[model samples]
Target: MDYHIYLAGEIHSDWRDQLRASLKEKPGVHFHFYGPQENHDLSDAIGEHVLGEQPNAVYKDLQASKINNLRTELHLKKADLVIALFGEKFKQWNTATDAATAIALGKPTIVIRPESLHHPLKELSEKANVTVDTIEQAAQVIDYIFA
Candidate 1:
């Protein structure tokens, strides 16, 4: 069996790595995980690197967002499933967008947001195939779904 999972969410924490570590390789099963560039500086600078400097900081952000959106669109298309996490530290509108894109593409989506965020994310979770509070539970759902 083969699976292509797009790890979509706040990159502030090591949740992606933790989830990867939790899912031990099963015999005859292969997992391919993909996500936005984990390097914050690199992800932020990619725009200027490829497109040259923008007029100002906000313009720089616009350039970065364009490229980032391109990558996200392509990855979401290729993903068999998406695990979108909404963290506590910052607002993650992009995470919600990614999950929505995955759903639009007909890919299964699993959302992770704490109970504290439950109300805010209710609509998104309603659209997602599953919602969990922790990466551990997300992994368990993956195991069950793809086992």
Candidate 2:
């Protein structure tokens, strides 16, 4: 079996890398990952790089997020599953948006976030197929999928 997974959410950490490594190889199983730019610099400046500078921060962010959505939508549609992280430090509303889109597209979703966010994210988590508080726990789910 083969799986296409989308890793979305806060970019303030390298949890994606950890998740990728944690997935041990299963016989006859393969995994493909798709997501936003991992490099913070490029990810943050993509709009300015592609569309030139905006007049202000709000305009800049608007343009960047719009551009980024193109890739996010494409991958979400192709993915068999989506695992999103909602970190404590950054207010990554984009993570919520991507998870919602994944659910809308009928993709199985695993939400990985801190316990501190549980209450506020309850509604969204209720929609997810599963929710865990760590990348390792999320990896365990993927292992179960391909097992």
What lDDT does candidate 1 reach at residue 75? 88
- The lDDT, on a scale of 0 to 1, for candidate 2 is 0.89
lDDT of 2 by residue, 34-101 (tens): 98777778777889999999999898888888878887999999999999999888888889999999
lDDT of 1 by residue, 1-147 (tens): 777899998888899999999886688889899988788898888889999988999988888989999999998998989999988998898888899989989999999889999999999999999999999999998888767
Worst 10 residues of 1 by lDDT: 22-31
Q: After superposition, how far is residue 78 of candidate 1 from its true place, in Å?
A: 0.4
lDDT over C-alpha atoms for residue 96 of model 1: 84
lDDT of 1 at 77: 95
Model 2 per-residue lDDT at 16: 87
Residue 10 error, candidate 1, Å: 1.1
Q: What CA RMSD would you report for each candidate?
A: 1.1, 1.5
